[model samples]
Target: MRATYPRQDPPRGGVRSWWGKAWQRAVEEAAYSEAELKGGRTAARRGEVGGISVDAGALLAAVREGDDAWTVQVDVPVLDASGRRSLVEVVAAESGRVAALLAGELPHDLVEHAEELGVELLPYGGELAATCTCPHYLAPCPHAIAVLVQTGWLVDVDPLVLFAVRGLDREALLSALHARTADLEEPPARVADLVDDLEIAADAVLRARHLLELLESDAEVPDSLL
Candidate 1:
């Protein structure tokens, strides 16, 4: 799935959003050299990057450096079915986490927890495959890097964009999330606080066996389990 974000007026600061900084860090760390990223940062700060489009496994943008205009694309591997479930499980672990993501804020540590569960919620910049219409031959030319910088802005506005980049669109995430947490919605309110040891043991065994696990949740299963 693809998600398009509108361009915003440039922010005075480099990146102030919670996930935006991490996005910037990933892009900067992936650079071949500081000098390679320097020009891109300058271009981005000057509002040369505009119109970001994100699809499963790819990011595209329009960048202008001086009189030249170029189209830039950066591709990253998207999550398969198992990976998506892993991500959903991680997010569904806490209602507050889902609330935070839907509210457009992603704490960096949330992704760290995801990493521990064998899910890569964010792409490693060094591993990105970038292409640009510019003359530069490097994978992430200045134009491409500039586009990534602008993409950080989009991530700030919608944390779900990260999911989209990893191949889960908004609706898919909601459906999967509901599926993962649906099981927890069962039980009467009076006894809902009790932990389900049997369910926990089963999930642990399934996880140990490399079986597909439902999304992690605490409540009873609701209708429509996937």
Candidate 2:
């Protein structure tokens, strides 16, 4: 399912977050050409890339060069189900991670915890699948690279952009965490609940006995009864 589009404002801070820097470095190292990387970063800085449509495993944007425009998309592999579950569990394990996420920040420790669980929350250089609609010979044309660079800005403002690319949206992530909170806040099992559970077990046992009685013959006792 497509996640809600993340709203991004330009970073008010003078420098990108450490996580954002990591993302940029990963992208830069993966790119085959430094000229393409420079061109892309330049376009992003000049606001040449329009609004990006962020999705699970995909990022879509239009990069404009003067009168020319081309559609660019970067495909990121979605995290597998096991990794996503581990991510949720790790985030829920720490109260600080939960609080940081709720406060619109991605905690440094959260990423580290994810790494411990064998989940790479950020895409490395080899993982980027960039393509462009423009007829360019470059494997990752300047337009596509521009979109990728523009995405780094979004990461700077809100690091959850990484999650969206990995098949989970920010709202869904928060909702999952909220469910964990609810579970923690849930009242402990009461005496009455335990009694009810015992009664259910008793009923199941009686039904099993009745079924065995019907199936057994007069000459033969079931091994369970013996």
Candidate 3:
């Protein structure tokens, strides 16, 4: 069976929430996948390096907390032209907890590179505000925009991914999933891929029969049908 789409939260205060806007954009631009988002090209200068890596499952787990705010450390790998790797650490903060992190309440180093990557720990109540360190004055330079687009897709699959960048763990996420569906006896089975050619053939036959019926009713063709 196909997975059912989740119900979206109602718009509030005559404005759509950042999360809501992200979701709408994602459905509208459903061209890229999670892997493509994470592994795509970067805008690092010839000798410069920076990259973003996120665990979608873990991030979604953190977002599910709603009232509870948490932080996580993400190691983004930046590479040079020669494939040399350098790590940049980011401290991701969640809604309601952004103030704390912003005020230096969190116990992690918000690396300079992360701040440059236009990383923002958006709160649940506000829009996703970001500032990039790239030379471009845009809130999200092309690189940051690419990352944000990918992040949106991740949230569609698992809302907690919104927090995963902030440092949520996998085991903790699984526990949360268990709690959400604790009463279910077993997990649902996965849907198999459809045979495209077979579906096309069936549709073609159906259309042909309908057309033949219409022609015969109008006395435009013989009753015999193929």
User: For every model shown, what is its TM-score relative to the native structure?
Assistant: 0.75, 0.75, 0.26
Tens digits of per-residue lDDT for model 1 on 1-226? 6777766445545567867887888898777778769988788877888778899889888887778889988888888888888888877676467656666668666789889978888767775778999888666888888788778777766778888988997778766755554476564332222123323543454354222223332334434442
Assess candidate 3 and give its TM-score to the true structure.
Answer: 0.26
> What TM-score does candidate 1 reach?
0.75
Task: List the candidate 2 regions with Cα displacement exceeding 4 Å.
Answer: 1-14, 181-185, 188-226
Error of 3 at 71 (Å): 20
Higher-lDDT candidate of 2 and 3: 2
Under the 3 Å rule for N, CA and C atoms, how many clashes does model 1 have? 10
Off by over 4 Å in 1: 181-226
Candidate 2 per-residue lDDT, tens place, 1-226, comes to 5533333334445336787888888778767798888887777777788888989899988878899888888889998888888888887687556445534467888888899989999888888888988887875777777777768877765677778888877666755655555566566345234434544654465456545654653446556544
Error of 1 at 87 (Å): 1.0
TM-score of 2: 0.75
Candidate 1: the clashing residue pairs are 182-221, 182-222, 183-220, 183-221, 184-219, 184-220, 184-221, 185-219, 185-220, 186-220
